[model samples]
Target: MSAALSVINLAVLARRLHDTSLLPALTPVSVGTLVYPAPTSTVEINPNWEVLYWNTSVYGVVDNSVILECGTTLPDLYIWSFTQPGTEAIKAVVYNLGRGPKIQKIAKTLGQLTIVLKSADVSIEKLLLAANGLFTCQAFYNIDEDPKVHYYYVHLTVRVPVSKPNLLMTGTPVEGSKLWMHCSVDNGTGPIKYIWKHETQNENITNLNESNSVIYVDDVKRNYTGWYHCVVSNAVNTESSDKVWLDIKFGPDDPQIDVSPKTTSEWGYTILETQNVSLLCQAMSNPPSQYLWFYNNFQINIGPKLTITRILRNGTGNYSCSAQNSYLNTSSSRTISLTVYFGPDNPQIDVSSNTVMDRIYTAVEPENGYVALETQGVSLLCQAQSNPPGHFIWFFNNSQVHTGSQLTIPKIHRNQSGNYTCSAQNTYLNSSSSRTIHLTVYCECHLQQY
Candidate 1:
């Protein structure tokens, strides 16, 4: 008995136990041996497994590899199986008999397969499109009689990258016709989403399609003509197709007429008489446009530009350009008024009503002519006919006196009795006309016997 007790004490010391009892109580030890004093180590963590490690979702691409984890539990046996996208049957792919990985023919058919026994992870290599579905990983730690079996489910999706897209169309779009545009892809996985983009307009036109893969226009307008492209996208990747051109055939638009040597006026354009001018017509049309020029409602010239060597008073009226598209049988016209500023024609200088005109001389005395005037509040008047009206300048004896149409003398003196000149100027035309009149301011003492 003593020897048996000594053997029991030695057995307890070997186990590093401090209990004095010969047969002490021992807590049940877990199946696998702990690597360290604590528990937190496994295989390398893939960022893709952040959701799949605890749950049952996994995403993978075709001809690629995936890792299916079975938590942190260490198992003695592992069996990998799979269920296709639309099946309820579970088929075994590979298994590990606590020895090493042995891949089955089913696994080889799907792709290359590996079972990592150390970390309880199933690695699928060279994934195939047919391998997309739910996968089940069954792990066992103890004997089969009362086995602690763990079941881990992973939902796997195999995807194919999106290929370049294509658009099916024939010729240029015509106005007032049925317009149909179709966007197609060679192959892709999952629910493919299509987005249509107008490069020139910088807008998304996918909303224009009810199915989101086609574009429709009942009556295409000019604004719809531009470069267009389609983007095909799925859960795996996205790709954009090459751009295509959509030309909408229309008619000549309203013509825009512009003139050279043009001056801006409140009403229209202003030009000096005898000045060279050119009128240009601009219009947008499919087959170009024929231009016709009109002056005062009279057709005068044809072509895109009309040249006038010397603009005259007769040409100073409403000028118009008519653009006609022969192909579409449509025409547009625009008009602009041109003002030709000619001159301060002929200016005449005259004395005020209070001034007396000799019987021989007229009221408006000619230059170097005589006018009878004294201290009778004599004033000079300058009259002229001009296109923008005329500004008059007064000069006495060729010296500048005032700058108005009327020059008044409050008191007439002999010094003021020199040749008074009035200059009428057309500032716009830069032309001037002048008339000089001689005034004789004599005292009544010298004026005898009328």
Candidate 2:
């Protein structure tokens, strides 16, 4: 048993010495009963040697498998080796036997290196930061060939996830103002892509492929205000930064006034006396607005709205609304006119008499008599007191005659002497008052002038 074990150990030692790191010359070896020409000059090399190059950079993460490329395309015998950074020792890992369809490794094809040269690639598994190094793939022809050896190299770097990033802002955050935001991280692998995230108007998260860490907004609006942050990622892992609040401060726009229970007419607003009135002021501001109400240029109320119960005639005037934002120190104002309708009060009727002393005047009365000379002009006027001007209607003997505040007769005749009534009406209030006057025309005829 001891003699057989010694023979097995000697055979393994011979195999190790044959596949050493140094390039070996073509030689002969005997196996059992057959003699084999070891590695001969019969191996041919293709001249397309310039096609292979070194892969200078490759990134990988810990505990992950990384494929390191050996960019050789020639089908010659190959040997795979590795050299750690800051080291001069070259460790042989795998080699292809010159014999047909034979691949051999220094150890079994399992742990550190699995040479898959069918694709000219070496896969390193269960990697560590210490596994980062330079890998070499060497192609060799037979000993008699010119330039018996060529080598291709690749660098492998094990990466770690990026640390927590930091965000920055430039310029003021206000409406219509330009703003810029930046994101940065201290540690991460290169070729890193940055992603920006923000809370939108509806409070939903959105992602942006902003290319760089900097984000630019040309014209900021109110909707741009929200929570903002950044994420940095590579092939390995991704990490997010702390969130930042971006609040935009804006202006108090022009104020608007709305009055309830107010009707609009051809003249203006018509409001009834002893009615409920509500004035609501509206304006857009960043911090909200404080409302101030003005009547006839006098400040009367402070709030967003004003309510007056049992409104009277004194409530009629030019009303103004102003909104102010205390933080922005800005204000906006709007003005409007309110007309309160009340009349028609007592109506007055005045009639002309030939003699001024006997002129008949009546106020809200039934009737009065006026004596006027025939063939002469006479004028009658109607008057009333009201918030809005009252319309006057004249009737003769209770029949509608004319629609005017005044009535004039071009020629006073006997037939025109009758009861004339002047009625005053406030169209908005639907109230009316009237007065009547009767005119009597007489003829003072003498000798004819022909």
Candidate 3:
């Protein structure tokens, strides 16, 4: 028989023997025994073999202990004869439900019989069934004998389990700022699914389905600054890591200036003598900054404000200051002008006081009514007045006669002088004048009193 027909026949026999109930009218009764039917096979194997069977057609009837004969007629078989009377051996062949045929045997002799199969072309189920069943033997003659075949089958199943997920963070969090996290597993075969959770009061969070293990938080708040982790899972298992913290940083604001000697006037001024002037520059900032002073366009080498001691005329000019920090720089102030005053110097005069005389005559002849006589010096006095007076000069006959303002004659002689002129001058002004006089000298009258 073929392997396919044997398997089909076995299956039919099992269903009829195990599944069919004989009495359909039987009902359950109180205080009576119950009957249960046996289970039918979903699959089966057939052709049970017995231990004492042999090919009667191929070998002459020896006793039950006879070994099968080998001849030119059975080219594929080997037979060995034994002396023991009751010993017997049988070999059975079966076909695999999946591949080829297999042989199995049982021996009842003290001696051994080795049966070698042509090839290992049989399925595992067929070999197992042949080994499990009782042995039987049959004989076939001629090349047309139906090929002996048997059949067998098998079934398989599998199982899997659920797991917990885990998450990881890639970078640190910025203070009061956003954070980013990544999800992964310790040991799993995966394309894992990722999820994120915030353990806040609201428990508001989201799930992302991407192959990448990172998640981002935008526009983070103070409350959002908390323990954060991730969940990574697959069809097989899931896991999570420990929570992490985050931190963020910020900065300072702009600055301003305030002038001491509180003056609301856009420009500040002070009446300083030959003394030092101090200016205070103040501003608002996170950290105090350095102060720089500027005069006109040039930067001042001094402190926040420029100080000039014995402030002279040159020390006065435009002034300004600047304040600077790491973040920002700013300038504030106005230009100021200074003035100085003084007194006048000593004064002087150019004038003189001296004696000088001239003579004048009415006529040159003595008969002219007593001969009136007039006399004058050659030069006259010239005087000038001042706090510290200057020098003066006198002129006679339209010529300078004295280095000073005055000219003098000892006696009024007849030939003493003619015209006298003088001039006075100083830093303030100048003046000039001229005078004429005549003089007479008479001898003692010698008439002898006649």
What local distance difference test score does each model get?
0.70, 0.69, 0.36
TM-score of 3: 0.22
Q: Alpha-carbon error at 156 in model 2, in Å? A: 3.2
Best by TM-score: 2
Model 3 C-alpha lDDT versus the unseen true structure: 0.36
Query: Candidate 1 at 131: error in angstroms?
Result: 0.8
Q: Write the per-residue lDDT of candidate 1 for residues 114-181, one digit (tens) a residue.
A: 76656778787888887776665655554333334355766677888888899876545766666877
lDDT pick, better of 1 and 3: 1
Evaluated against the true structure, the overall lDDT of model 2 is 0.69
Q: What TM-score against the true fold does each predicted structure earn?
A: 0.54, 0.63, 0.22
Rank list by lDDT: 1, 2, 3
Regions more than 4 Å wrong, model 1:
1-55, 71-74, 117-120, 144-146, 167-178, 201-211, 259-273, 286-290, 294-302, 312-320, 325-330, 334-450
Model 2 residue pairs with clashes: none
Query: Could you give candidate 3's per-residue lDDT for residues 1-450 as a string of tens digits?
Result: 222333353344335444222111212121113121111222122233211222222111112121222222332212221111122222223322223333333322221223334422212221211122122222212212322221111111111212343455544343345566655455443456666655644565544343466766665444454456666665545666666543322211222333333323233353233545555555433235556666676887544454555654344455565556544343334344332211111212222212221222235632211111223222234444331244555554567757664565433444433344444444322322333222233322411231
The local lDDT score (0 to 100) that residue 418 gets in candidate 1 is 70
Query: Candidate 3, which ten residues in sequence have the lowest lDDT sum?
Result: 150-159
TM-score of 2: 0.63
